[model samples]
Target: MIKRIFAALLCAMAAACLSGCAEQTPPPEEHTGTRIALSMASRDQFLVTVETSVLEHAAKNQVDCTVWDAGNDYVVQMQHVKDAREQGYDALIVNEVSPSLTRGILREAEDMPVVFVNREPEMSALTVGKNAYVGSDDSEPGRFQAAWLNDYAEEKGLEHLNIVYLTGIEGQASTIARRESLMDHLKVDHDFVYDSTAQFDRAKAQVQVGMLIEAGRSFDAIVAQNDEMAIGAAMAMQAAGKELCPILGIDGTIAGCQGIRDGMLSFTVRQPGDEQGRAAVDAALALIAGESLDTVSGVTLGEDELSLMIPYEPVDAENVEEYIS
Candidate 1:
């Protein structure tokens, strides 16, 4: 009996020692560099918000960072990604030019860490690179924007309502998703007529609107995918003596909100820029520690790279004074 009790005690002691050793193990080594590489499709109010948010977060965390503007060119952004990877950036963030180009980006990363923010990529998996991912859901913005537009249309009793959708860089993911989702809702539910997609660049959107006006076409509403295009469309509408149309935009930038206050913009939506910026840092940190982004799953941009779909709500003249300008 004495021998049996002694043996049991020895076994218990060994198990406790193992459990303590496991519990006391330190986390994995962090990445060696303080540098991060960031690229955006272009510099605009919306992109600026995302950039500023990321830069500000990096600054606060004492992380060294460099940002590049792709000038709205997929080729240029592609080269930038290749260069960033070669230079050994600790982590990379890209606001992709289009959904189609995203896989190419992943392939070029060479197993380095990468993440996409507001603009989601088209890859079908949660993991794109060895330690990276695209972003949050692409459909949430569509639903939110569609529901608001539908409600507003219903309230105003808008029939034969015409809206012009302005997009960013032709094939960009957010731009395409926003347009398709809104159009689908309009066609099947609201019976709205939103015709044509105008590139979201300020000059281009204005030019597109001008062509429509010159051709004797008219729109009852002008909807821009981002604030830059919305403001540009407004300028063109005023120039063409078409100011009677209601105008709406996304990316509730300071300027966009100001436009709403001035009665020039009927509404716009806000994205979670700060959260995305911080998320990129958090993801990189997790990767460096040999942990998976899956650890932050519930909060990781819908459990992928920081691809979280934040709700964008309508901001109009009614609430413009309180929130904008």
Candidate 2:
């Protein structure tokens, strides 16, 4: 009986030792370098340019980056976030499909850090410790447009300007902010002859402008939310045998820059797609490494010192060559 009792005691001691050893063992080493999942909202021209920059920066920084195209679907974007979390992606860089859908994305990310680019999420969705945004102030581009138009109108000696405003995606934050900024700063004597949403597509803008022209709406200038829309409007005006006036646009894309050089567009706001992309990558990597916003290299953080806004470069006939291909 004494021997059996001693054997039982020895087994209990061994079990406790094994349990302690297991508990003390460290988890398997994580993948080297900062692993990130870049969730793109769509494959539009601006986004494609940004994606190229992101890839270049990722290669330079040796970050393990994977891209998932959401195809402009909010549901797919949510699924992408879920998959990234389960796949152990260290961080998520999302160009949200829609800002209003941010809550679902945030909830799906749980503890994983999400670095939003281009489109902004709701302020409430930005958890200080887990999320950050990187982009230009949307209003700045509009202000730039207004400033240029104001100067142009003064030079042209126009007393009360007739304007046609071409807008982007209807519910987009950019669309709302840019329009508001332009309207707020526009000269008091200006008249809005026509305003319509073109969904930021050149084809759509062209069709809408053609219809307006057919309807006999007269305007001295066209202010587009983006270069594509401006270009489209120009094409429509040319097709209708109407005299084309100074058409302004934002997003100095390669094509947009060419338009300015060729005298198709009056001017454009060059929102640095490449620079923004690089900055976003750096921001995400910093978040993954538990680094402060101040430590993010090459990005100027906002007053909150968490988000980064790249300065908008104005591209017109004088500076179009520098931005053009």
Best by lDDT: 2
Which regions in candidate 2 have their CA more than 4 angstroms from the true location? Answer: 1-33
C-alpha TM-score for every candidate: 0.77, 0.87
* lDDT tens readout by residue for model 1, 19-79: 9998899876564457888898887766687788788877776777899999978799999
| TM-score of model 2 vs. true structure | 0.87
Compared with the true structure, what per-residue lDDT tens digits does model 2 show for residues 203-257? 9999999999999888888999999999999999999998889899999999899
In candidate 2, residue 273 scores what lDDT?
87
- lDDT value, candidate 2, whole model: 0.86
Instruction: Give the Cα lDDT of each candidate.
Output: 0.71, 0.86
Clashes of 2: 0
